[model samples]
Target: MDFCIVDWGAISSIAAALIASFTAIYIYFQWRNQKGAEVIANEAKQNIQDILEIIKIVSLIRQKSSALERSRNFIDFNRLYESVVRSSLYIDDCVEIKDFKKAIDEFFNCCLKFKEFESLYRDYAQDSKFIAHVDSEINLIQIRGFNIVNTLIPYSIYQKKFKFRKK
Candidate 1:
């Protein structure tokens, strides 16, 4: 009688190698996905913080009750402009965001109007009538800042963007 032999030891070793390879691939992909999620979360958090800071700066600028305080607004305005420009990159400027960028551009115009009006209001501090007229213009510009910040800081818009991207 003749007997045939099977290489059980080699077969088991090959099976072990295949299992390890598959496990390594699975772990790598899972790690990559988790890292991607961490990055997205950090971006969203940064954006929200920036939006709130912008709104707070606008409020501080608006709350100036004296010509001297408002006159010094250029410093705060500069900070606001820099913050907005820097945050724009982090603001999720994807095509799906629609005219969110247009609103951001509108801030430049709003800040310019505030700066000009405040300067006028401050320059004619000695004249009563000119101060009155300057006050009207400055008040209007402040209101514009208020409106713009309202639109920019809404959580619903950011939430929608975040949720859409999370998918």
Candidate 2:
């Protein structure tokens, strides 16, 4: 009778190699997923920054409009209107920003109407009704800006909290 001997050492080495390959593959996939997540987070942060810049432009328009109201000068009014129209192009694509844009449109339309009446009576154009309408539109813009900023706060907090973990 012939007896065959099993090579236990060879079997153990093969098993070890298989386990190491699997671990390496798993780690590679996990790293790829983490990189994807980081890219998404960075994009979100950039969007927030863009929204903020739009808000600043809107605020500038509001300030200029208010000044034009007080000064009752056509030059300032034209400048303010031009600024609002120009800044609208920079507004980010978001729900709150859309609302702000709507308010700006309404305000611009109101200004046009006011201009029509200004030729008849300058004082009447600056009446309480006109002031109130402008005030409401400005308030709406402010509210929308605040809401957009509020939405970004959580992302900022998350980034700050998790930034160290990536390192």
Candidate 3:
């Protein structure tokens, strides 16, 4: 009878050990899955941030283009066109995404139209009254776009260089 009781005790202990080992294995796999999920979530967040920055930049470019269109007579179209070109290059070099191509194409179209008006507006820069104001506005637009581009740079390097500037 004592031998029978000892055998039962040993069997129960082995059963408990087996259960604990299975539980530990299950927990490890669950932890691994959770870690992978967290990594995916973080990547998604980063992608969203990048997309948002691109959207804001595209909107700013559109607004600038609209302003230039309205100020055709008041602004130096050729200089404004050149500013747009510079911004396009900045976008292309800084961001590899193709979504900006449309905004860039619109800007190119504006440049082409400005080319038609180039012969007329080319000499307008010599007129001190128009040149001064146009140059100021052009500089403002260029600065705005350039600052926004600067913002798109990774937060690590970008923040170091452009800490106080608002985009």
lDDT of 1 by residue, 52-151 (tens): 5545554555566676666556566566556656655445442234555666566556656555655554456568786565556455545544554454
Select the stronger candidate by lDDT from 2 and 3.
2
- What overall lDDT goes with each candidate model? 0.56, 0.50, 0.46
As for candidate 3, its clashing pairs are none
Q: lDDT order of candidates, best first?
A: 1, 2, 3
- Whole-structure CA lDDT of model 1: 0.56
Which ranges in model 1 have alpha carbons more than 4 Å from their true place? Answer: 1-6, 67-77, 80-84, 87-167
Worst 10 residues of 1 by lDDT: 158-167
Name the best candidate (by lDDT). Answer: 1
Q: Please, what are the lDDT tens digits per residue for candidate 3 over residues 1-167? A: 35534688889999999999999999998876555445433433343344334334433433453445534533444454455466555444443433445545553553354344334444553577754554444444444434434444443232222112122
* TM-score, prediction 1: 0.51
Residue-level lDDT of model 2, residues 62-86, one tens digit each, is 3453545534544454555555454
Whole-model lDDT, model 3: 0.46
> Which is the leading candidate under TM-score?
1
> For all candidates, what are the clash counts?
0, 0, 0
